[model samples]
Target chain A: MKAKKQAASIAANAGAWLITAISLVPFLLILLNSFKDSLGASEMNLKLPGLPLQLTNFLVVVEKGKLLTSFFNSCIYSVASVFLCTVFASMASYVFSRNRSKINRILYLYMVLGITMPVNYVALTKVMMLFHLNNSRLGIVLLYTAMQLPFSIFLIHGFVAKLPVELDEAAVIDGCSPMRLFVSVILPLLKPAIATVVVLTFLNTWNEFVSPLYFLSSSTKWPMTLSVYNFFGMYFKDWNLVCADIFLTSLPVILVYLLGQKYIVSGMTAGAVKG
Target chain B: MNKNKIYPMWFAVLALLIYSVLFVLPGLIGIGYSFTDWSSYSNQLHFVGLENFKTVFSADENYLKIIKNTLVFTLGTTIIKNILGLALAVLLTKSIRLLNFHRGVMFLPSVLSTLILGMIFTSILNPSSGLLNTFLREIGLGGLAKPWLTSPHYAFKSVMAVDIWRGTGYIMTILIAGILSISQDYYEACSIDGASSWQKFRFITLPLLLPTLATTTVLNVIYGLKVFDMIYALTNGGPGKATTEVLYTAVFKKFGTGQYAIGTALSSVMFVFMVVIGFFMIRMMTKDEVQE
Candidate 1:
């Protein structure tokens, strides 16, 4: 009986390891191919490079794709969108939490609707044309902000509601205005939730593909994702270059994840639980 | 009461204005456009009534298939993701070293862009010289090697596998949070009473984690309905549209083909579908929450 139990334990452990390897293989293959030449990548060897690493694919992808311009464009959209969305969400969440009126409840429902509503680009295009938002970075940013605001507000409101009402009471007694109170007292207290919103908005805005694909017609104004797609379309047969482009496109997100892993993990789990 | 309320009602009004203009107004306009015979070719727009919906529902066999595919994809992904997520969460929560590393590895794909991941998988799943097939052949299991994305029977399955791979970690992390919140005293008592791991899991863990499961499942359902990037990148709804196209892709195709009104109509159907489904799910989940 002991021997059988031990054998089962060993088998379980091995199974777990096997699953992990399987999970990691796709990523590992991409990583390996990113360093190989076109011929080598076409062969799709699971093994590491047998020859010296070639920088040519990376260079070609960068040059052909005009990656630097697209990277900068992505930065503009991501930063502006995240900043605006976080500020608006935090402010809206604050007001919605403090006021327990019919309007607040209705607004809360309205915001929740945003989460369910898909971005109706076909319809939005008419509005965009009306506002001349089509094919513009500003236009995309506004749409993103509008789309993200609901979730951010929902997340922030959950945290805000739990906060002690005493803080607001005391601040009010001390003659603090609502704006002042929110900025000084409530805002400081809402750091973790704000951090959560900022990271999420940042990630979503940075990696957004569909909006950019539709709204931004000019290649000069395309974000990294659209740029990567264009690169692949233009270089359909160039697997090596395509892999290189993929690596470049993913670098910023991977870097952000590594740097803000703690905050991202906590924020995600918190949002999940409270949301 | 008045003195504390410095921002006044207009601030709320302002926020509402942005919400209405950006989100609500667009959705309403979308419904309106769905009724018209609008397109890029002509500015003389005319109301087409339910013609577009009729076309979508009856004109093309693919539309119905897409809807079915969307349902399957969403149901399949949500069920599998949550189950696996819960199981993994329970296992990883055990007293194991390198738990953090394993957690990080699992969560890695969630952080990467779907477009990039799609490109990577496209190469990896290629049949002629793809890593997956190459490995299969080397192991003398070459029969299992198949053109994953190209084969109609396996295309949707392939897309779902990639999605599961990307999403399971997220669900796992959420479940872990749920599991960790359960106090250990119950588990300790169970162990003292000679309750086996499976019994403790089935009784204590399962019931306690219901709320989290409900919330996570609703979120997954919303995500599943809106799936576009991964499918768009993976197969572009190709291999003769064998994989699930869903409403979003249908709308996209119509828009791309310059049938703007029809596309907006398809989108309207999606809007109504999502709203109905989303309302039902939220109500169900919140009712459960109240019970809990």
Candidate 2:
């Protein structure tokens, strides 16, 4: 029985390693090829990068791919959207959760229903043109904010319900203004949930591709994902440069994922396990 | 305390206004535009009843194939991702070394831009020198290798495979959370009754996991239906006539060709389909919350 248990443990461990390898291998291929010279990376194998890594591939990609401009654009979009999305989502969810009137309930459902509603990008152009937000930075930021609000609000609404009403009463009795009650009292208490919102919003905004692909026309204003794709198209033959470009584009997301792993897991799994 | 003052209605106005104008309003107008002769080439809108949707549903057009592809992709990916995710969740939750590391690595694909992954896989799935075929050749399985993305026969399946690779980890993480939340007391009770491992899973875990699986399914369906970035980056709905063309990509192509009416019609179909799904999803997700 003891030997059988030992064998099972070894088998499970092997299974786990094999699965891990499958996931890691693609990323490893990208990383390895990203450092190789064009000739070396041409075949796209698992071979180690050369001894003197062709770090120049990154410089080439940066210059030709307009990495600096796109990276800056990506940051601006992500930060602005994260802030707008979190603030609006939390505030809306707070009110909706605290004040559940009949009308509000319907409105809440109406807002949350956007969670699954596919954006009609064709008709959206008309709306964008009507508002003169067709190809502007502020327009895209607002678009992302709107896109992210449903899920963020859903998350915060569930969180707001767990907070005690007495806290609100205490704050109101203490002569707190409505804004202060939310910003000073409730917002602080909502830190964990807010963290989740911030991480998810940032990640989503950073990785957003379709919206930019549809709306943004100028290459100068493109985000990293769009720019990377454009770069791939133009430099299709240069595997080293393409690999390097994608590596750079994916770096921020990977770093953020590593840093905020807990919040992301908890955020995505929110209300999913409540059976 | 006045309910009006503390939790002001203005708080929600920004969110609702943005969502309405930018999100929901477009959907409504898109449905309306679906019936009209709306196009970039024409300035004036002329009402044309069911013309575009007819083209969509007609056997004469490839739009039907696109719709079918979208449904097949959604159903296929959702089911497979759920199964694989459940299996991985179960495996990783066991006594394994570096378990968190494994989980983190697996989940990595989902967080990164699917477009980038799609681009990466294009090279990996390249027939001759791509990593996959090369590896197969190295392992004496060269005969097994085929043109992954270029061939019409394999392109849709390849796209789905890449998507499953990206999404399975996310589902696993959710399932892992669900499994963790299952009280140990139930398992202890089962063990005390001399329940075997498979029996414990079959009786206790499977039944309890149904809700999480449902949630995962809902998430997957929404994602699968709206799939654009991956398909756009990987296949771009090509290699043949509407082979891998899902709704979003087809809508995009229609819009790209200055055919606004058909694009809006396609989106409207998706809008209505998703709303129905969204309704049931909301009920299922909030069922326990409402009770509590």
Candidate 3:
């Protein structure tokens, strides 16, 4: 029985290692090919580079794809949208949680509609036309905020429910107005939940493709994902540049995930476990 | 300031106004436009009741195939994703070294843009000189290798595979939370009752996980129905449209072709379909939650 158990343990360890390697292999493939020359990469089948690293692919891809500009656009979209989403969502969540009026319930249900509604891009386009926001970054940002509000509000409401009402009472007793209480007391206590909101909003905004693709028309204003499509179109035959562009586009998201890995896992699972 | 006298309705109204302007009004207008003959070609508009719908539903127009494809893609990906996610969650939950590192690596794909993932996988799955084919030949399985994204038979499956790769981590993360949240006492009790590992999992883990499973499955179904970027990037509904075209992709194509009314009509249909399904799902899940 002891020997059998030992054998089973060894098998389990080996299996785990295999799964881990499978998870890492695609990323490693991209990393290595990002540095390989056209002919070398095409011939070599995802193997590590032979000797002297060829930095030409990265340079060529950057110049040809205008990766820096794309990166800047992505940053603007992600940062602005995340900031707006977090603020509005947190405020709405606070209101919904504290107020028990019928209006609050109705509003809560209305917000939840956004979560269930299939993103009507056609309708959104018409709306954008009406607002004269066609092909504008602000247009895309506003749409993202409206779309993301439902989930963010849900998460913040869950967190706000657990907070003690005494904090609100004490702030009022100290002559703090509602807005001041929210900023000075409530917001600080809701840091963890706010952090979760920021992380999720930032990640989603950064990785978003469809809205930007439809809304933004100018090549110069294209986000990283759209730029990848442009690169593919411009260099339809050049596999090397395409691979390099893919690597550059994916690098920031991967870096962010590595840095905020803990928060993302926790934020994603928080509601699942509790509710 | 009278706290009770102060109404929060004003703030709620502000949010409602923004939402109505940006989301609800457009959807309502879209439904109206679907009935009218609207397009970029002419300023003249006519009320063409059910004409667009008829054209869409025509058998010769390939709309039905698109709908079928959408359903297949959704059902296929949702099942595969949830199953794989559940399996991985179970494996990772065992006390293993470097577990956090493994978790990070697994979740990497989920964070990257779908368009980027689609492009990267396209290269990897290329027919000539792609890594997939080369690896197959090296391992003496070259016969199994094909132009994954180009072939009609394999294109849809290829898109589904990449989606599964990209999404399994998310579902796994959720399922892990669900599994972990179950009290340790249950597992200990099962052991004391002479329950085998499989028996314990079947009796305890599966039952406790039903709610999470329901939530994840519903979310996956919605995602599957609305898939766009992956399909667009991977195959573009090509190779004779062997892959599922789905309504959204069709709308994109129609808009790209400057067929605004037809495209909006397709979008309208999708909106209604999604709303109906989403309502049913939420109702069912919440009802189950209450019962539990």
Please give each candidate's TM-score: 0.94, 0.99, 0.94
DockQ of 2: 0.82
Candidate 3 residue-wise lDDT at B11: 42
lDDT by residue (B1-292, candidate 1, tens digit) is 6622654554455456666776778778999988889998998999888887787788456777887788899999999999999988987787555677778878888888887778778877888887788888999999999989998888899999989989998899889988988999999999999998899999999999998898788888889888988888889887775465777777788889899987888777778888877676545533322110
**lDDT (0-100) at residue A171 of candidate 2?**
86
DockQ of each: 0.52, 0.82, 0.51
Better of 1 and 2 by TM-score: 2
TM-score of chain B of each: 0.92, 0.98, 0.93
Worst 10 residues of 2 chain B by lDDT: B283-292
Off by over 4 Å in 3: B1-7, B10-15, B280-292
DockQ ranking from best candidate downward: 2, 1, 3
Better of 1 and 2 by lDDT: 2
- lDDT by residue (tens digit), candidate 3, A1-275: 89987887777667778867766777777778667777766653557776677778889988889999989998998888788878888877788777656767567666766666776677678789889888988887777777777778767876777787777888788888777878888899889888887888888887788888778989888888888898888886666677788887877777778778777887777545644
Q: Which has the greatest DockQ?
A: 2
Residue by residue across B1-292, what tens digits does model 3's lDDT show? 4543332444445455656677777777888888888877888889999999999889988887888899898999999999999988888888777877777778777887777777777777889877788889889999989989888888888888889988998899889889988999999998999998899889999999988887788888888888888888888888785465777788888877767788888878878887787666645533422110
Judged by whole-model lDDT over C-alpha atoms, candidate 2 comes out at: 0.93
A32 Cα displacement, candidate 3 (Å): 0.3
Model 2: how far residue A184 lies from native, Å: 1.3
Question: In angstroms, how far off is B202's CA in candidate 2?
Answer: 0.2
